[model samples]
Target: MFVGHYAAAFALKGREKEASLGWLFIATQFVDILFFPFVVWGLETMEFVPGYTETNDFKMEFPFTHSLIGSILWAIAFGGIFFLLFGRKKTSGKSIAFVLGLGVLSHWVADLFVHTPDLPLLHGEPKFGFGLWHNKAATFALEALVLLLGLWYYLKRTVAKNKFGKFVSIGFVLFLLLVNYLNYYVLPANHDIIGLTISALVSYFLFAGLAFWVDTKRT
Candidate 1:
């Protein structure tokens, strides 16, 4: 799903402008963030299988992080944390909790559109996905549409508060697309599970840092 997950954050930010886009960005990717560490620890696993899917080479086994039930749990946890962090005078605790929880849940929903049947309904339940990843053209269209539309809506809804805001925001979008392209098309295949996990974590945090920078420059 990649940057498509950010669409939920962007849309939610339009409604809850007070919430930091950085948090929203983290909210949507929290599961993946966890998944990376779990993979590094050998709690979850993946293996490179060349040409198994259009964009993904790894055969993923990520029950603890990508399972539907696990995602819901993560969403609830994030919502609770958000309520505690942002809940204050003039801030609605319940509203922030609900929206942030939904933001977290949106990651699984977006992944369903592109993942192979590697996502689980429960730790032991049957896994399911639409297998959109096998169709590169469709996958590209869906990702681009979601990412661009979200970015457009976000830009339209908020005015830049500093000169750097617009530049950073635009750069963020370009960076996401470039990373996606490289991961999908250009990067050499890697069987080193630990390295893959580390790279994924680095990429996620890199974008998170950029989101924080962009948010700082926005109203």
Candidate 2:
């Protein structure tokens, strides 16, 4: 689901211009952000079996972070915290909170399209996914299409504040596409769970920071 998740971030920013795009980026990947640490803590699990899926080799057992109910709870928690922090100061606070919560929940919905029945309804079993990851080309195309559409919507809704805003926004979108390409075609399948978790966390925060900078350059 990787960069495909950021489609939700862009869409959320488009719909709620007042909401921070950077925060939306974090919200959209909130569960996955938690999933990696959970894996390291023995609260969840993942094993790299070569050829587990056409795209990568991750066989995950992440009920607490990937379950439908768990996502809902996480969404509520995120939205609740936002409301608590800003509800009194801004008229659109509730709206921003809802958008952030939706961003959090959107991760599961997006993953449902590509994951191979790893997402759970509760703690175990009855897992579900459309398994789009079975085909590499389809996975790549779908992610690119979704991300481009999101970027288009975002650009449509927000006007650039300066030259840097216009060019950086475009460059960032291209950068995301490049990262996606490398994820599918260039990067070797990582076998070390610990190393993978560290890299995943670093990438998540790095992208969020970049999104924040881009948003600042805009409006």
**Highest TM-score against the true fold, candidate:** 2
Q: Write the per-residue lDDT of candidate 1 for residues 60-145, one digit (tens) a residue.
A: 89888899998999999989877877664445667777888988999999999899988999876588889998987788778878
Candidate 1: global Cα-lDDT? 0.83
Which sections of candidate 1 miss by over 4 Å? 86-90
Q: TM-score of every model? A: 0.91, 0.97
Clashes found in each candidate (C-alpha, N, C closer than 3 A):
0, 0
Where is model 2 poorest over a 10-residue stretch in terms of lDDT? 82-91
lDDT of each: 0.83, 0.91
Candidate 2 lDDT over residue span 1-219, tens digit each: 888899999989999999999999999999999999999999999988888889988899988988999999999999999899876488899999999999999999999999999899987789999999999899999998999899999999998998878889779988988998998999988888889989999989999999999998776
lDDT of 2: 0.91
Off by over 4 Å in 2: none
